[model samples]
Target chain A: MAFPPFAVTVDLVVFTIRDDQLCVLTIERGEAPFAGGQALPGGFVLPDEDLADAAARELAEETGVGKDAELERVHLEQLGTYGDPTRDPRMRTVSVAYLAFAAQLSEPIAGTDAAAAQWMPVASALTTSLAFDHGQILADGLERARAKLEYTTLAATFCRDEFTIADLRHVYELVWDVTIDPRNFHRKVLASEGFVEPTGEQTSQGRGRPAQLFTRGDATQLHPPIRR
Target chain B: MAFPPFAVTVDLVVFTIRDDQLCVLTIERGEAPFAGGQALPGGFVLPDEDLADAAARELAEETGVGKDAELERVHLEQLGTYGDPTRDPRMRTVSVAYLAFAAQLSEPIAGTDAAAAQWMPVASALTTSLAFDHGQILADGLERARAKLEYTTLAATFCRDEFTIADLRHVYELVWDVTIDPRNFHRKVLASEGFVEPTGEQTSQGRGRPAQLFTRGDATQLHPPIRR
Candidate 1:
């Protein structure tokens, strides 16, 4: 018995914070099936490449961040796989989607497959119809990111290496689209084991008292997750 | 440029509680590559079938549970996808794995692809060398199940329709392989709103006081999650 063959591809949903808004990287399709339409950067996987390696390779190519050091900071994981019979018009394709979280990243350089690549606010991007089933994939990624912030130290990924409690709180506010009590947020962050470690340095604004700076802690999961 | 064609298959890690121990469904392979070795029940995805539909179909076939009502009670979800180049020696095959949580289920009947099917204790199953990369897949599935119980109302899926607080707590203890204080466990479960709903019924076990009976709640996630 012969099973039908499939073409496996990898699509990336790389997210970052820009100008206090959650943003995702997107590319304009350079060739048909969806030419000129905005879509997540991806392509067919090489025959022998691992699924995760294929995702990372796509991320590097689309972002133009060729250095392993820069890519290492980006938290990447398999979001889900999309394989509707008609998701791809041309062939039977199964797409393994990856979700990535990174601090502010440099402008993306379009790969050979994409006409143009740029960062777009998630809100505005959602309003536009993306090429393929990318709109659904982006929404799923956003939901995962929002939920991850409540239980993981992932919010720190959107901040600088050394940041104040307020800076981290702001990331939560922007991603969750709600205002959080600063004092409560501060208490929770400190209480959660290995969530953050103080740098023993302080940063002062123009008027308020200097705030202690901290770096992301070694622990990835929050024991008592910070509830939304 | 011609890309290599690959075969996509679905593998299930169906878990349940039996004889006070957590068990998983396994089948003895009847084909080459790992003939006679124990493996998860699954098969190739058809050309036009959805990925999830393929998984459900495989589950139905292996268990011989033809009724949809019976299948609906089982909580199934995508675990992850494994596509290591040589994971399958016969060819390059990408396996989309799924994890399922179920209460006590009827004995399984071997499908055409499997020589025999039975429920094996997860502890014992992990000790043996499973076929292909199934051992790794099973480990990942178990980790997902353990972590899910902490934040989601997934533990309820391992219980009967009506159960006492102790019944629910036992599910946690058995799955986590830990002894939890009954009083503390009760308090946490009640505090986590929407974790369970009182059925206004009581069950008298042996000489102990009649414990209140409860059913799975409408909420799928705990707000202040029950921490481990």
Candidate 2:
């Protein structure tokens, strides 16, 4: 029987804020299909599992990060797939790309089958030595994250459940890397009906100004659209 | 050297508007992977080609209706890749799902896979006895198209260059199957900077009220987001 000539790989373009800049988690490959090259952290998907579950499993497996983390939990979503026939050297391989967003991290532990794993600044990651179409995947993921922040309360997903308006603003500022007018930002968030609700609490985060703490609003959409 | 156990296939979730309902192009598989069964129009991706290009090419090769019928003018985009090990009975196959949006069509054609190619309403396509994760892919494509209509002039991508405002409005109404207030739609569309521009023209649609002609706008962002 002629063996089927296809393969499946999972590539993760995990983004996080590091040193006030958007960064991507990537690794130097250790074997063929792209050995000794920088690429997104991923591997062959196993049998008997859903795609999203596999992605989460891979993320934790590689990082050795527990199910829970200190930072506002990272969010993961399916990005577009890439399957240029020649994307891999061994054979025709299709890759499902997933986008992940984590809070600002001190450092990411690059996991197994990788020479090393580290957070590379997105600007630098934009043009890279990524093995396959991962550079494109990384760009796609970052664009998705930026666009998502505009219409959904997703930016808050990158921050803790309890946050000051200032904390919420930082998610936008870091993800978009643009300064948002605080007065305008505050008015916009509060006005978004279910965007953020006052928790009847406050945080002394600024050392002087007692900022009011709020939780994510019940509504899923951001009306009047938060300018990304 | 041991060969990499990977396979690549391209599955098309071809969509069209028929009888004012969303539909997809499908084929009856007569070969092994899913022998004698109904499935999306797809096959093994060949070596030395881009996946998206391959998908579009396959649609044309199978239907003999490329770049002509609005319902066949493949506007293909990657949906997502499925790479679970047990997805294929023979070996590990990574299917890169592609989404295609064609305008309304008159008739269907044969698929390249030596089976009947036909158009079925999106609702019925759901009860598919297809192979792999095609069901999930179809759902994702529909959701993406629905969400995309809110922002980009991507809906225009489903139609020809010069179409009437009523035609455009109908696209939204038909795709979402929701009645959009024509006047409000026109107003909201006109308000969005790059949504629709005055074509300084009209269409003699051979009926009452010759619709006003307009083209896609320049701004990419939908200013004053369109509400669903």
Candidate 3:
């Protein structure tokens, strides 16, 4: 039986922490269907390209980041797929959405199909009307990131290679939009096995004593999850 | 830029517990590509239909179940999407996979494209070489179901509307293939707030004294998760 033809695309939600706030990478559409409107940095999936590779390529093209170097520190995974019949106006399209977490990233450069590319604070971005179903997609990505932080060690991806527990707590605080007690967070981080490994190094936040440094551990999941 | 045309399809991995063993629904293909081989129940998405609607339609058609009645008791969610350039020999097909859980489903009847439809033990199904990357899809669905059971109250979907705590425990033991201590399991389930609600009813199992009956609770996620 003949089936309806579809045009598959990949959309990205690349998130990073900057200025103590969570920001997402977005592009200003240069083409029709939402010209001059904000949208996630992504494009059509090449016929032979793998879904993940397509996401990486789009990330590199839109942000001017080298796939090899930048992706080394980025934690990328499939968020979900969006295929509402009326989601896209051009034609029958199915978009596979991916979520990525990275530490402080460099400035972005606009791609061919984008008028501009830049980081937008998630709070303000939610208020602005985004192109297509991107507003819903971005909201879903944020929720996934927040929930994963409760049981996974992914928050470490938002910090430098060597960071103090305070730096890590700031990541959770900013992303979750909550103030977590430093003392309680420290105790819980230490109790969860393989959550962090001490680097035996020390660093000081201005006006504070030197604090021990640590790096992400091998365990990807925390047994006794830190509740949100 | 012109992109290669693609066909999008939906595949299902419906799972249930029967006779103390976890089983999955599968069908034998009636057409070429993998004629007479075992496969999941699914079909191509209609031009104007929603992705989820396509999945539910396929499930109902292949299983001979009414969409309204059967879907009321089934827990269905998107598992993931698969799109290897060479996954399908005839065309470039991208399949969105779905996973479902039901309680004591009725016997399945064959659909138009299927020569036969029935339940197969998950253990044996894994050993059989299923048509088109289905083996990998099945494994992924199984893993998702097992992990969700750890944190979600979805395991109750495999039990009757009113069941004893032992029935719930059995669902876990059979799916995880692990032997959990009965007393410890009982205490943990009750301690997890809103995991289950008492029905003020009792039922007898064999020669054992009457056991209190309960139904699924309002909570979806379990705190201090029932660790695997």
Candidate 4:
């Protein structure tokens, strides 16, 4: 017995902190389906692979960054699925886009199929010619990431594992494009359970006050969330 | 130059209020790809149709609910797209699933393709067999719906244009599965800008004490959002 064949693909919205600004990983598709145009790093999901595995694989493959592989652990999750009939010219495909966030990648590789791979600021990514409905997908991913910071204390993911409150606050300001009230922001961060835990250690960037260092909070969920 | 071929599909996750609990519309698949199993209503997206239009079309075809054919507009939006090359059994297909919130459907007609269409409560829906990863999609949709209530007064879309605070509160209870303090909820509702406004009317409800009625407020967003 045979079923109507299905096509599954993985698109990666890999975001990294570049010059303190959150940017997304993008590639220039060297082939058709908007060939030679800018697009999210993605490709087919093989039969033996799990959906997430496919995304991880496509990400590494499209970026061509990890011939040797970089971080084995990158935060990746299903963003959403887009399957507009006219999205691709060849066959019917249901593309599941995954949103991945990394602290920062320096020597990231380029995909064999890509003309070039680079991290573009989200603002700039919006204006470029994207291969498919990728522009919309990127917008959704960015919105989700921004909203996530409100309650999840996920901004710390953008910083090194250990950072100061000032460093974390800067992430919020950069991502939200709004300067938070430093006093209020500091109070709120400390008050929220599982938001952050202060480390006794102090940073040597002592030109100003020796800022206190901290790590991610113990709690996974935030209550009465913080929003801009 | 021809665009690379793509196979497009539409997956529908229909949410309805059943027994004051959030429920999802599901179908018993008649054929393969998890044949004879319950699944979200979906099919291959047809060319010459937009992604949203395809989802709307699938909703109509599978559940006998169509925007044009019916008087009440179905609250529909792009939930996101899922394209993992192996999600479907046949070939490469990209699927865009729509998240639709229908308050109380007066007419729920099952189309010929599906064996049956039923509103399964979320509690038990998890245990029952769904065709594929539709369960994950359904869960994400519910989570999105729940999160949306925090910042945006979108719950009104689940009710008629004019509703009482009690009705709005009921929506919160149903979606969140948590009881909210009435007095506190009232105060919170009033505090958040553009959440609700007095309709200058009261609902008799065939009772002694009339309840104040309200309509959806302005499009202002919630700051320090209410978490579920």
lDDT of 3 by residue, B1-228 (tens): 477788999999999998889999999988888998999888899999889888888888877555567677788899999988888899889999999898886664657667888889999999999999899999999999999999899999898889999999999999999999999999999998898999999997689889899998988998878889
Could you tell me how far off, in angstroms, the CA of residue A191 lies in candidate 2 after the best superposition?
3.9
lDDT of 1 by residue, B1-228 (tens): 466799999999999899999999999998888999999988999999999989989988887553668776788899999999999988899999999898887754657668889899999999989999999999999999998998799999899888889999999988899999999989989988888899998987778789999998988987666667
Deviation (Å) of A219 in candidate 4: 3.2
Worst 10 residues of 3 chain B by lDDT: B63-72
Error of 3 at A45 (Å): 0.4
Better of 1 and 4 by DockQ: 1
Candidate ranking under DockQ, highest first, comes to: 1, 3, 2, 4
DockQ values for all predictions? Answer: 0.79, 0.52, 0.76, 0.32
Residue B134 of model 3, lDDT score: 93
Candidate 4 lDDT, A1-228, residue by residue in tens: 223344667888988788877788888787876877889988877656666778878877755434464544356778877766568767666678899877776565557667888888888898887888899999989898887887686777777778888988888887889899988888888888888888799998768778888988777566756776
Clashing pairs in model 2, backbone N/Cα/C closer than 3 A: A6-B6, A6-B7, A6-B8, A7-B6, A7-B7
Q: How many Å off is the CA of A44 in candidate 4? A: 2.8
* Top candidate when judged by DockQ against the true structure: 1
Question: lDDT value for candidate 1?
Answer: 0.89
Between prediction 1 and prediction 3, which has the larger DockQ? 1
In angstroms, give how far residue A188 of model 3 lies from its true place.
Answer: 3.1
State the lDDT of candidate 4 residue by residue for B4-39, as single tens digits.
344566788888776788888888888887878889
**Native-referenced TM-scores of chain A, all candidate models:** 0.95, 0.87, 0.95, 0.90
Q: Please identify model 3 stretches exceeding 4 Å from their true place.
A: B191-194
The 10 consecutive residues of candidate 2 chain B with the worst lDDT sum are B65-74
Candidate 4, DockQ to 2 decimals? 0.32
Superior candidate under TM-score, 3 versus 4: 3
